[model samples]
Target: MFFNHWYKLVGMEALNLLESFIQSAETGSFSAAARRLGLTPAAVSKNVARLERHLGLRLFHRSTRRLTLTTGGEQFFTQVSDPYSALRDAFAGAAQDAGKPAGVLKVSMALAFGREYLVPLLGEFLALYPGIVPDWHFENRPTDLIRDGFDAAIGGGIELTEGVVARELAHTHVVAVASPAYMKGRPLPRHPSDLAAFDGIVRRSGATGRLRAWTLRNQVGEQAAAGHRARLIFDDPEAMAHAAMHGLGIALLPMPHAAPRLESGALMRLLPGWYADNGPISLYYPSRTLLPPRTRVFVEFVVDAFRTKGLARRFDGR
Candidate 1:
């Protein structure tokens, strides 16, 4: 029994055991490591305990508040971390090289933006790569890429975490828009300051939980507050757009959400010369060097599609 256990702790069988240890050591918590590995904390703790028994070395000094590394753990981590990462990357690269893009490609997206824009391209994507399956989660808020176990995410205003990177899909901007009916009798704003006269359908910030304010700028280096007197406020931009389309009030909206409505004449752009820089809409994923074939292809496909469709120019508030 002892010989069997000792032999199992070496070579090929050790890879799975080391994965739990490396992740736990790096994160300094079993729960955080569990999230990254898609396992429960108890499972991770057990794996570490099992490894310690096999090695006859205590790896961590555990407490309710924290898991601190023992001397043995620190030495082991320093010796194995780099080589383990390299081994994992090599295995991933080999698997990617062995075949075409295949298996589930999980992605997180912003709710309305994905449905309105990206959903239209799904048929083409799946048809081209039949082996790949898409699992998408659409939500309005920013997500932690590593903690959430997402393969990739599409949205704006994302803060990058360590071991994650983003590619700029488009430069995003916000514009003021209202239905034509709402603007018809009302005097059209000649300047940003003139917006104070109109009723505003404003968006509340999810992070701050307060009404968002806009500072609009023009080409000649002039800036002014939108000065919209709030009539209806919503937590979601989609809701604000919906209210605007029904002529509830003028709304400050990102170009992606406003573009379709503007083209269809359901909404009219207010103050064409003035807009706010909202930052880049990016494709966020775990390490570029470690990307799977499915993720790499999807990223390329989206980037190419945006270029082909002239979405970058359309999204710009020019």
Candidate 2:
């Protein structure tokens, strides 16, 4: 029994060494693996070296700039990557069964949506799950949920990838809005085509570097237009809203972003019946068979919050 126990201990150490090597290979550097694994660079390198010795194969081509995996290493990585990920997730799920949600919950979200809808609820979420730390980034651009190590992300129109799933948090609608001051003497747009006559506040896509066109639909049908006479252009939704509020021009904005200003009488919805269907705002995460408790609970919390506040339908302009 003592010999068996010793053998098992050695096997476990070998697994750790393999794990370190895998991290190094995946991150392309021992230093990056060390940061991820909370180990020193020298320690990670030592572990990888030990792994290479045990296998009797050089695993990486080390250079001043970066580490590249050897042919043998690449083959081994392909075999182990999926199983390693599954094992780690299983262990994490088991750890999370301790009855209280804990650890870091990293989230990426759109800035305007987070500020208007998500930020205010975080105080209550922390109050409820004090053990969970919220590590959140609010940006306008899409993020790689897995590569970036995010627990989850919230955004609209996120392209679904293999091994990732999205839960619909709410549907978002877009509307044309302008400050009442800006339209004080200007004739209200009687039709979608009339928007061409006004100065427009446009939003450019950060990822594509293209100006987003305004697409509106009503009982009649869909009408698409690009604002060529842009009075102001911004990549951020908040900045566009502010510019519209300052009477810069007519801005096509998301309902949630414009809702507050509209309520305060700073901005008025143009062609109220005509609006754009952007898509659902979704919470995206890896589709693990057993989700971590922190991620599961946060997803539940956000869904409940939107339901309780009647935001899901309201955001859709219902």
lDDT of each: 0.85, 0.81
Lowest lDDT block of 10, candidate 2 = 1-10
**Model 1 stretches astray by more than 4 angstroms:** 1-7, 10-12, 96-98, 288-290
User: Can you write out model 1's per-residue Cα lDDT over 1-318, one digit (the tens) per residue?
Assistant: 223444757775688788898888877789988977778999999999988888788999999977899998898888778778788766655553236677678899998889987899899998877778898888877888876667899998889989889989899889999999998878899888888789889888889999999999999999998887999989888888899999899999989888889989999998988999998999999984667778888999998888897888878885
39-137: candidate 2 lDDT, tens digit per residue: 898999999887777666788999988999988878777876777777677656665424677888889998778888899998999888888889888
Q: In candidate 2, how many Å is residue 270 off?
A: 1.0
Against the true structure, whose TM-score is highest? Answer: 1
TM-score of each: 0.86, 0.83
lDDT of 2 at 191: 77
Which lDDT value does model 2 have at 5? Answer: 26
